[model samples]
Target: MKALVLAAGTGTRLRPVTHTGAKQLVPIANKPVLFYALEAISAAGIANVGIVVEPNADDIKKAVGDGSRFGVDVTYICQEQPLGLAHAVLVSQDFLGSDDFLMYLGDNYVGGGVTSVVEAFRHDRPSARILLTQVPDPTAFGVAELDDTGRVASLEEKPTRPKSDLAVMGVYLFTSEIHEGIREIKPSARGELEITHAIQWLIEQGRDVTATVNTSYWRDTGNVADILEVNRHVLDTTEGPGAAAGEVDPDSTLIGEVHLEEGARIVRSWVEGPVVIGAGTLITDARIGPYTSIAEDCRVSGSAIRSSILLSGSTVDGVSAIADSLIGRHASITTAAAGGDSHRLVLGDHTRIALAG
Candidate 1:
């Protein structure tokens, strides 16, 4: 079996950041979320992988390369536009060939990984199988209606009135039959060829469609909240190798759960855990704590950073505090503005703000 990872979307929701980088490349605990997916795919024993990317394919290609790093033979398929999920599969037909494959959303995060799912699919070889989870708001997702016997009877894509709370998770198992289904379908009112419609068509044609209720954690990291939530979830389970205090001053007080990467220096600061300070970062006279991922080459001085994911090349100036935020690459946050004593930020577009005085 092969794997197809859809990463073509423009990620409008994560703009400014997405404006410069692919959403899949955004760091969760200083590691790209896309890397996690690739790791999962590799762990599942599927090495031949096809990645569907947008016009900015070079960025993703450069980061993932030939997928050799992740133990997968990678193929990059370009999507002319953000048409839809089914359209992505349609374009990747050549790469996918006749093998049953796993279609994974590049920006989606499944907590337990797809190893077991892949194992089960390989064993049973169903025409198509969908991962489902009971969501509070099924209206936001493609929902599945289960029969009395617990079989998937119908599928609806973001319906006005959901028949079930079971939302279709981003992970999907598909056989070669989906190509024909994609070819036969028409675009939805949204002018996109949705995969949900194709699956419904397969079910209508009596194809052996199965649904597995995902009990483990699964999140589609489309928005900011989901991204942070996934980050927190991943960190909660992550056990670091303790604080690798490289250049810690005697006055500095480092507490539990700090991961100071190589060349990271902490001086006269108090740090509490689950903090992951990236390589070559400097933390001086600062309070770093709980749920902070400071990316490589960052400079933090006399500041407090908590519950945030700071991308590479950012700097937090003296006396500034940031929490519960996603800081973009090369961003600078300072204590004083040009006019007076107010926070100043050289930020990008779609930047969400909840300022603290």
Candidate 2:
């Protein structure tokens, strides 16, 4: 089996961050979201992968060149526009010719990977299989209705009145027969060729459309809150033995599962983990709280931060407290004057802010 990974979407919701970089490249725990998806594809025993990328996404291309590092041979397919999932599949027909493939979204995080599901798909040989999970807001996703026998009875894309809570997870397994289905379906009301329509087409023709409810953790890291939540989840679950690769001053206090990368220095500060300090980052006289990830080349001094993510080259100095935030790369947060006021900010790349009266 092969894999088709979509990384072409213009992430409008993510705003200024996505404006400059691919949403798939956003880091969760200092790792790009796209890297996690690629890792999962590799773990599924599928080495022939085709990555769908938007035009001018050179950064993504540079980061994931040839996929050799991930033990997969990658063929980059340019998806000219932000059409739709089905459109992506349509354009990738040549790369995916005559082979069953897994379509995985680059920004989606699936805990435990898709090894089990890939094995099941290989054994069962369903015409198409979709991963489904119960979501609180089904209207935001492509939902599925299951028959009594647990087959996919129907599918709808972001319906206003969803029939079921089973939202389609971003992972899909499809045989070549899906090509015909895609050809037959028309664009949805949103002017994009919806994948749900193609799946529904297959169901109408009596194709074996199967659904699996994923009980494992799954999240679409689209916005700031979701990204932070997924980051916290990754930190909480995978924080095993604390290994500090960098220098820690005798005066600093390290607590709980903190991973400090090479060149990261902590001096006279208190760091509470489940936190990861990236390479070349310096923490001095600061209180780094739990569930926080500070990316490479950052500096935090005289500040207290908790439950936040700071991208590479960011600086936090003389801030009283910061929580529940996502600070972009090369950003700076500092105090203008001594004040008791607290600050909350969702800053984008290259931002600079001085908190004061």
Best by lDDT: 2
lDDT of 1 by residue, 104-154 (tens): 999988889999989998998878999999999999999999888666899
Per-residue lDDT of 257 in model 1: 72
lDDT of 2 by residue, 198-239 (tens): 999999999999989999999999898999999999999875
Candidate 1 residues lying further than 4 Å off, grouped into runs, are 337-357
Candidate 1 at 331: error in angstroms? 0.4
Model 2 TM-score (2 dp): 0.98
Task: Score every model by TM-score.
Answer: 0.94, 0.98
Clashing pairs in 1: none
RMSD of 2: 1.2
CA error at residue 172 for candidate 1, angstroms = 0.3
Task: Give all candidates' CA lDDT scores.
Answer: 0.86, 0.92
